[model samples]
Target: MKSPILRLDTMKFTYISLLILVSPILFLSCKGKFNFSKQKAENEKIVVQYGEHFLTDRDLKLILPKDYTKEDSVNWVKTYIEEWVKKKAIVDKAEENIDELTLKEIENKIVEYRQDLLINAYNNYLIEKNIKDSVTDEELFQYYEKHKDSFPLVKEVVQFRAITVDKSEENQAERLFNSSKDEDFDEVMKMVLQAGNAYHDKDSIWYSPEYIAAQFPELNQNDQLSQLISRRKVKISDENTVTLIKILNLKPKGSTAPYEFVKPTIKNLLLNKRKLNLLSELQNQLYKEAINKNEIKINEN
Candidate 1:
């Protein structure tokens, strides 16, 4: 009942309409499936918060030191996020005229710095792994006893030899005070002062003045001679011989240094030394492994 041209036109219109309806369906069919499981897993990650800033587990994994525990990672990430926010705030306030090239250069430098930090973090992990609270109280006591002379008081004393000059060059033994200078000896003395009077032997230096006075009780007791040689006050013993007194150093009285006084400091020192030893061992092991696997290459220039 319709004309041929009208029928053809109607059929063409219908075909176009069908395409318009079907295109989206076809496109969607070719697309990959939606991964709700992956999305859920990503969403379930732990996130750290600091004020308005937030950092997820994934973010922490990037910045966290190797071998950090879950709690440590969380704490560290919170700090990191806060710091990052502060930096971002500062950057936002910075002038916008900074060239894009400079920004890229800074970004590159930041990447390098992060890489260096990663290496340091791994080394710190090695150290932490080896750290031990191994030094016992008994061991400490024994160490103190064996090295009792070792733990000198803050005011150190020394037993030293000195050339006491007298006035008469003939009898350099006992006379008036000598003014002549021994140039070589003076030079050596100057060097000693320059070198901070560095002691050659630890054993030679005594920590207790009482112990020293005990050794030379007679000389120490003799008020006349005590004042003559390195005593607190100088006194003229006789008219003919002037006493030239020289004190090597002062040693305060020694006692058992309170355990509380040294315990924390000793613990930290011992711990750090142990950790350093462990780090050295790890570094050696790493080097050996790298060499075995041809990981290290030295370029000759």
Candidate 2:
């Protein structure tokens, strides 16, 4: 094959390039409305031509990121042209070398793939237009209750509150940390904030051991943390700082995940089930309508 010819109009190219650079947001915003085929037929310039195949400037414009610099854009266009030429050359060679039987098989497979894509797109459209997606909390809770065993924790999880303060204030912080009352916890949080100390009160959220270790590496250093059935206070002290943690709840690895944690999963499962049911109904309705209209004929042997 002859070397691919590059026929670029410098003034036109510069004008388009400047337009892309000046207002990238404008180009991006108009992308969905841009009619590339019509533009190509009317005024699109050929960036490179490989054998009988050619690549248009619009093709490069569509693929190029809006924020790329002039130097980056030039390099990118060069690379794109090289790759495009190689791909076209390979396709041309395949056309010339592939046997008739293989070509026919390839064509058949392409047709089958196109048909599957069309059917899936139509099915999705029907589902989006007709299906009502309104899942309730009650439904999610019911699903969780029935299928709790299927959603077990792979690792131990804990819900806890922790406070980090100076060693000098450990005694007072420990007292506040050990307290079960919300008011006492709030007072400690206020004190910690005033003193510019660290405090966490995510008792409602479940965290893995790794996450806990990351928050308080001192606790995991000696592997002092263990599975607790009830609330337990843990204190760790370094040279200057002291961390006090209260393990509010602990769920073992084999235990079912908390309802709050797996609620989203339950909702998704229910939604998928509803979608399948809707699709099945649509299929049956279409078949029945076709039969009634005598569009589908059954010949008895």
- Give the top-scoring candidate (lDDT): 2
- Model 2 RMSD vs true structure: 9.2
- Once model 2 is optimally superposed onto the true structure by TM-score, how far is the C-alpha of residue 250 displaced, in angstroms? 1.2
TM-score of each: 0.33, 0.72
- Lowest summed lDDT across 10 adjacent residues in model 1 is found at 169-178
Per-residue alpha-carbon lDDT of model 1 for 1-301, expressed as tens digits? 4433333334444433433343332122324543222222445442332223334445545676666654454455446555665674566455266788988888899999998899689867766665565767776666566665555455434443333222232143222212234464354445444544321223334334444345344446556434533453232233332233334444444744444445566677667777777767877998999999999999999
CA displacement after TM-score superposition, residue 242 of candidate 1 (Å): 60
Report the Cα lDDT for residue 135, model 1.
69
What's the true lDDT of residue 20 in model 1?
Answer: 39
Candidate 1 wrong stretches, greater than 4 Å: 1-41, 44-128, 137-139, 146-261, 298-301
Each model's C-alpha lDDT? Answer: 0.48, 0.71
